[model samples]
Target: MKQDRHVSPSVINRLPRYYRFLRDLLGRGVTRISSKELAELMNVTASQIRQDLNCFGGFGQQGYGYNVELLHKEIGSILGVDRLTPAVLIGAGNLGKTLANQVNLSTRGFRLIGAFDKSPAIIGTDLVGLTVQNIDSLEAFCRRYNPKAAIICIPKEAAAAMAGDLISWGIVGFWNFSSYDFTQNHQGVTAVNVHLGDSVMTLSYLIKHMDGFQEEAETEDDA
Candidate 1:
């Protein structure tokens, strides 16, 4: 299906969660799902699901519901999750090591081709089955592996420099864990900032609101 070229970025963000849920439903032998079911699962209104689906071309009916397998495939293709993406991680610091150990890279369509660090002691060590290569090997790895993107886990001070280094070596996209504002010299490169503090603050707001809700519910029960 030919998708509309001008879909909103918010819609794009919702695709991954929708795709994951649809994939799960399919795996559980679910053939069809109502928009209401999706909306409840995703914490949105049924109309919202239907509208988003319609933005990418319709997938559901008024009463019969949507075909789970078809929705999964469409979302996968739209988000580029259907294809494998080669990636690398730089800086073997605490945060870097944490990210490395947290996920099994073999699943999830991400191939961790290599890791780099400036520490001489850590160089040549093994991390997540890939040997830790020195920062000097960055260009070589980019040439050999030709990864689509890289994760910058180095300190804030080193972020810009490492990003430039990656850019020099043909890394077109970056998942920047370092809190640095990047100035892109190349037209194709994209840098996504992953601010840990902002995420924590968001979680804190949720916790506070949930506590308030519980207090209100207790008062209502007393009444």
Candidate 2:
């Protein structure tokens, strides 16, 4: 396993894409693939693919390229997909229910041990086979299950206090959808904050600029 911590975050981010493509290739009975071929499939340059993989000690041979199955396994190991990480969800709202039902958490190395909510109405409800527990029981539940990660789907106003509570109960990682900056509030916490509104805004910006780019291209072609 590549244990280098010096790898850039950009390179780290690209590893999952490499893993996914490799897995798909393996599924399609592709035994080996050259960097150029993989790059073409991923819409990236061959040199960029080589550079990203090199950060974790590139597996491709000069003539043989990379073994699809082996590369998938290596990237999986790097991403800790083989390890089952216990996690708990901290809300039972519409978004939370959707995530619980739709996300294949176990396939991606996480197991949702508990789902929680403050409302009595939602407390006893079933969410993806796990019974929704009251928020008051969070501390005891965490102590019992000893989950390493917390999935925060509560409102932004309630996020900080819940995060602090989870951190006190030994949760080290957070998948935050509450739009609260957990990392900023708590130093050394591993957090991935998902802001759906921000993502939509970003996509809207890209689409607007891409239309402008196409118009410019058309004008240049006419000229």
Candidate 3:
């Protein structure tokens, strides 16, 4: 299936989830599935599944449903999982090391080409297979490898300058673990600032104010 330039962000965001479910289906040896069946598994409407897939192009036939393996492959292609774009990490802290070792880089379409840090202790350490290099080597390394993306795992105070340096080095995409917000002035840059703290706070809110929790507690006490 061919990608459309003007697809909605919501649809774009759901592509990975769709890709994951399809991959699971393929693993289960399922050969084909109707939109309704896929939607049920995804907790969405059948029409929604059809509409989202139709954004790229028609992949289903009248009576044949969708070929599980082929659909999974095509969705992965659309998500750029086959691209393997070169990527680098700037901060070799605990979170950085964790991401390096745990995250499936190939499935996400990135190849970790380099890792860098300013601390003397971390500079020589091994993160997965990549050696943690001195921060001084970052610009030169980026120039050599021409990494298109960067994973920022530094503190908020230093994120701005780091972003500037990366932009100058021709890095256009960022997976920022810091809280810094990169807005309009970034030009052609595409950044996803992942605030782990904010996510925890969101979970806190969900637990503290969850619907029917208070009533359930009262009923339990009475029981």
TM-score of each: 0.44, 0.46, 0.46
Where model 1 places Cα greater than 4 Å from the true spot, the runs are 1-82, 106-108, 178-193, 196-223
lDDT of each: 0.66, 0.70, 0.71
Q: How close is candidate 2 to the true structure, as a TM-score?
A: 0.46
TM value for model 1: 0.44
TM-score of 3: 0.46
Per-residue lDDT tens digits for candidate 2, residues 1-223, read: 3547599999888997887788668868999999899989999999998888877786878898888998899888888865767789988888788877876666545767789999899999988757799888989988887887767788766876565666677776565453322122144333233454434111110121121111111111110
Model 2 residue 22 CA deviation (Å) reads 34
Candidate 1, position 179, lDDT: 38
User: Which pairs, if any, clash in model 2?
Assistant: none
Please give the distance, in angstroms, between residue 183's alpha carbon in candidate 3 and its true position after superposition: 22
How badly does each model clash, as a count of residue pairs? 0, 0, 0
In order of lDDT, best first, we have 3, 2, 1
- The local lDDT score (0 to 100) that residue 95 gets in candidate 1 is 74
Residues 79-149 of candidate 1: C-alpha lDDT, one tens digit per residue = 77536567788887777777778855435446576899989988888786567889887887788877766
Q: Candidate 2: list runs displaced more than 4 Å.
A: 1-82, 178-193, 199-223
